[model samples]
Target: MNIAEFKKNLLQDKISSAQEWFFIISVSLLCMIVFISSDVFLPFLPEMTKYFNTSMSLSQMSLTAFIVGLSLGQIPHGLLSDRFGRKSILNLMIPMFLLATLGCIFSKNIEFFIICRFFQAISASACIVIGRSLFSDVFEPLKAQRAFAVLVPLVSLSPALAPSIGGALSIYFSWRSSFVFVFIFGLIISLFVFIFLPETKPIEKRTKNLSLLSILNNFYIMLTDLKLLYYIFIVCFSTAVWWVYAAGAPLMFHKMDYSAAIIGLLYLPAVIPYFTTSLIARSLLKTKSVNYILNIGINGMMISCLLLFLLESFNALNVWTLMISVTLVTGSNGFLLSTAMSAGILHFSKNSGLVSGLLGTLQLLAGAFSAALIGLFANVFDKHYYVNLTILFIVCGSILSYVLKRKVIKHEAIKSF
Candidate 1:
């Protein structure tokens, strides 16, 4: 079929089962690519520090820059995709990602590398925003929740796997090899999108008013909605917990004189619990309410943080203890993130692109803040301090989540009355 006919076919109310699976897999991969960009270079941070003659904090700036880009870039991507179309914006983004990856691979200094990573994240952020919006475009509320559960575990694999891949590449070649891998991955995904991915947002569905004022007003409205803010913060807190662990764990391991490869292998154990709880969360959805599942998750996180504090206090905290505690935190998040995100998006289904973008931007902004926080306190504090600080953040988040859950329930009850 010609381009117009092909596009029209994709915009149908119902696609074939095969097409559905293809779309799901493609979007999952897109999400994975963004996460890989975030985490693949983690194992190389120490090496980057030595090579660039910079401090660990400076090297960590690459991560902060990328996350900041991931955060800020989502707004524009979401706005444009809502105005233009998903596939077209994705097509534009993948090329930019490829170019940024090249810059990362060829950078002569840390400053230049940091800039490249930022651009790389900016481009890759489209995947996250549009990938989420596509689900809302295609599925009803209930199906979208299940789809998100599936998507979470798949995307979670990247953070678990990317460090291992980067460690192995650093062992065999150089740190730049990780960027090469990312570049190749981006190229393949670009081609796949060009050939297979469809335009989910048709002309009739797109936002007509593309003015700055309209966009700003939309942002204002969403920002003022306490329900949406609560859901977003739930995801954000979970995200921050993961990033704190991610940012601190590597440094802790490196200080212990562990090899990069072993440090990479250390992340593997968390994946088991993460995947298990995600599946369990999916199953729980069949019989339980979203609030019920969220309660379990929030409680799990608090209990995990308490355990970490107890372990650290008794001087029993080691790599194994730390990892086990973090595994639980990650597991709890698997239950929390997808459920909260889907609920929020479905609640505001008319503005799925904007919601998706706002959610991602805030989530990664939380992550970026956690990473920067870790970097700021890394040298001044001992390992125990990191653990303590992490616990504090999780506890605060859990408490806020509880308060917000109450508010949401009260607000909904009043509306029902």
Candidate 2:
């Protein structure tokens, strides 16, 4: 009935008639600041390459390195969230991110820029992964799924709008100024979260020593679980497809004669489906089975990829066709990411924070590896490379779906046993 009652119900895992949508919004806002800096950066890669006088592969190092930092921080941040708390992690990340962006703005050398990107990744990624873990901690299972459904769209808003923002800003100012906007966004979110966001983790559940052996033990348990592994594979696979687009799309745009601004605008539309479907996925959470939703989404991705291959086979090279395929993949992610995350922590409620950390680490680590590999086939100003890039990403997503499907069967078998 009141705030205290609502909090109690949420923690006790009851989905009553409470609207904690604002909590999801706050976390999404925090994540937007993080995603904006990283996701939007690639749209300007062509321009940045020219500015920094770096090769395409070399320029890519900055992105991959940032991702590596994101992967590396997942466990520690999750452990810290368990102990020091989510609000603390949120507050700590803000200043660190702001400083990292400022570093990007002022850095005169590629090495320095790459280092700053890495630092930024370490600070910024905490907001999303730990925040997701907190959501799992607070809400009932169905409610958590619905909450992420609302969030997927809002979170999708960042990737959709960020490039358009970056492209417009880069055209008017130097690429460095884009980092300044990231700085400002981080500063604003930090203030709001610090001032208003409530602490989710209790002192009792917190762990002080996040030693390697403990981490390994946690991971070992997770890997051995068939359900969690199945869901995580979807997260990894769907992300690979997204990265495929991320790697190839800009070059494709340049071939289409779109400037950075135009390329970003084109990129923006694909994320719309993601935003829309996230909201839909949340609503569907109460009604549909996780497997049902996942099957539909994975199929959509597979179909989207197959179509892309068809277009390639037909020599049908255009931005619109590419956009259609991208939209399907992004939209499907709306369902896939939410389901995977919800399922991931559900099986390990005792170690929700640690579970969040491991899942977060794998998701980012898998995405980074996929993206780095996908990047190999895509080059700046080379349209031909997109074919291979697309094929590779589609295959990755397909393999993920196939493996995850097998894991799903294993999960059911364990239950039957």
Candidate 3:
């Protein structure tokens, strides 16, 4: 088919061929693999400390370095892709990721390992920001939301699943095996992308000038949109809540005498609800408005946060209770983030790459900051402080939700008029 016809079918949701679906699924896999990267080696973190003979604090910097690099890398990659084209950026990044993974596998010390992970994260981040932009390139706004609804829940499964794989690999082979597995996975994916993935950003549509000022101007314009900013903050805060949970949960489970394998299993209850909610999100789009879905998601998060507060206050620290509370949080996160992302990116259709990069950067930075804060307070604060942070985030998110609702209503009214 010709280019116009192909785009028409995509916008119309006529993904008829197996290859088309594979393309979509492959890109989604690109998005999902990063999260797997995020957590696939988490189960081996303590082992890594011992293996490298590093302090606990230094060992944990592996995660921090990756987050920081991922956060920092998005904007530049997005801007460059917008200027230079997407396919080339993808080709460059995937190979970088392959190399970085190998570096991690062979690093002699924690410092080198952390540096390798940072580069690995930088390379993997291109897939995420570019993947979001790719949806806008191929699908119309509504179709893109539906696609996100379906893909995100599946993507959300990575955190829980990766750790299980990591725990198993660490148990059987070694910590290095986890990196090897990822390297092999990255190699295969990269080969597929290089061979099959076509450039979505057409030459005529690309920015003519590759200037820092032009990039900054694009960001300035998008950041000034109050409605867009609100959705961005919603994504940011929601991500922060999840980050805190990830940071604190391992310690909490350890205190409760759970091994990494068992902890991985415990995450399933929470993840199952999250996946179910994502499927629900896809269906909800047919009958419900975006604002309605977003509002409901916010309420869900608030309710989940309150339950966590109550449980922590009462010292109800059992597995079942903790599972239920976290399930609510994860489910609500799945609900809110997917919708917020769709709405936020729709506002910047003229520059999807830039906005996707900004949205991703903000969310990752929020999570990074939360992780840093948790690390800082690890010694000073009690374990229950994690729950307190969750409550605080919900309070902040609730206020942002209120503002977002008001702004969205006003924007809609203005558009209607």
Which predicted model would earn the best TM-score? 3
**lDDT (CA) for every model shown?**
0.83, 0.73, 0.80
- When 1 and 2 are scored with TM-score, the better candidate is 1
Q: In model 2, which residue pairs have backbone atoms overlapping below 3 Å?
A: none
- Superior candidate under lDDT, 1 versus 2: 1
Could you tell me the TM-score of candidate 2? 0.82
| Backbone collisions counted per model | 0, 0, 0
Per-residue CA lDDT of model 1 for 1-417, tens digit only, reads 254444455556366666656667778898899989888888788888998999999998898798778888887898889889899899888999999999999998999999999999999999888888878887776667877887877887887888778877887888888999999888888866897677778789899997889988998998878889888988899888887877787787888788866877777777778778877887888888888888888999988988998998799988888888988888998898888888888777777888898888788778878988888978755568768888889889988988987887898899899
Worst 10 residues of 2 by lDDT: 13-22
In the range 1-417, model 2's lDDT, one tens digit per residue, is: 366665565566553553465567766787666568876776677777888888888888897888788888777887778767777787787688788889998988788999999999999878776667767678767877777666556765776677777767867787777888888888778766765555767777666657788767777887887777787777777666666666566767777788866776676767778777767777777788888888778777777768778888898867777777777778877778777777777677657767777877777666667566656655553544665665676676667677767867977888899
lDDT per residue (tens digit) for residues 1-417 in model 3: 354555556545566665466666777788877888878998788888899998988988898898888888888888888888888898889989989998999999888899999999999999888888877777777767877776667676777778778877876888998888898878778866776566778888788877778777887888778789888988888788887877777667777788866866676786788778877887898788887887777899889888988888789857788788888988888788888887787778667787888888888778878887887877654447767888888888789779777887899799899
Candidate 1 clashing pairs?
Answer: none
Order of candidate numbers by lDDT, starting with the best: 1, 3, 2
For model 1, state the Cα shift of residue 142 in Å.
1.3
Write down the TM-score for model 1: 0.87
